[model samples]
Target: MGLSAFQMVYWKACHLPVEMKHKALWALKFLNFDPHETQTKRRNQLLELEEMQLHAYDSSRSYKEKVKLYHDRKLVKIVFNLRQQVLLFNSRLKLFPRKLKSKWLGPFGIKRVFPNGAVELENPNDDGQQQSWVVNGERLKHYLGGEVERFSKVMMLVDP
Candidate 1:
């Protein structure tokens, strides 16, 4: 008995050599093309592809959400109030290679609080001039050190 069209296609996919060219006319006469069955198979394949795509999207979204949650849990909320003393972290000092010196710059006072973790700092100098600058709040830590008392006394001696 001659092979059917379904068997011929299956044999070709499996790398089996079938002599179809010699019996090409006979194969065409026996070829049964059911349009309804072909359409049903195509629809099933499309549905499977859509389902796989949906699964991939769901997996990626869930992974992103898990990553976000992990990072959020590690976040430390730093709050600064006006006139509060804090030390500014000096990131540039690492390049100079000074191990003994402190990396934190100043016992700067908070002048203004801006939105999104930004704070304006008042310069630590005891001079009359007060300089202020804006910096990220993450680089600052609370200052708990002692306060220095400035003496304005001036004594003069005269010969009697």
Candidate 2:
């Protein structure tokens, strides 16, 4: 009978009857057992599992970086220089506004440019009072005021 190291140790620890103790020791002597081989196999398996986890993490990180680059490319680059006149978007205006109301608020002049995309705007009506505000570049656009033809409503006389 072949006995493993653990089985042999367990038999030794337990107080077996006198007749069975000799037979158990004799069986253990003929068995081929290597504890170091079992330990090395377990260590190798753990190392392989760790390598697989690292590879999965790297692949996920690279995919996220690619998506970020794609989104960053779609963003519009609108930069304004100092003293440039730009119209501010009236975001506060509601969907149902007054009939003759315009969506844009200003032809505000850019007073200064911050390191970020924010610009300090100055009112054109220089009333000796310096009232300026910093706003994001996305809220402003270049003012294009030109001779636009206005369309007037014409009533037609129809006989029923």
**RMSD list, candidates in order:** 13.7, 14.5
Per-model TM-score versus the true fold: 0.60, 0.53
Q: Against the unseen true structure, what C-alpha lDDT does each candidate score?
A: 0.72, 0.70
lDDT of 2 at 127: 45
Superposed model 2: Cα runs more than 4 Å off: 1-38, 89-104, 124-128, 146-160
TM-score, model 1 to reference: 0.60
Clashes of 1: 0
lDDT of each residue in 6-79, candidate 1, tens digit only: 66877643323455553664665578656588799999999999999999999999999999999999998988
Estimate the overall C-alpha local distance difference test score of candidate 1.
0.72
Q: Name the top lDDT candidate.
A: 1
Residue 140 of model 2: what lDDT? 86
lDDT over C-alpha atoms for residue 51 of model 2: 99
Per-residue CA lDDT of model 2 for 3-55, tens digit only, reads 76767877644445985877766665657545577589999999999999999
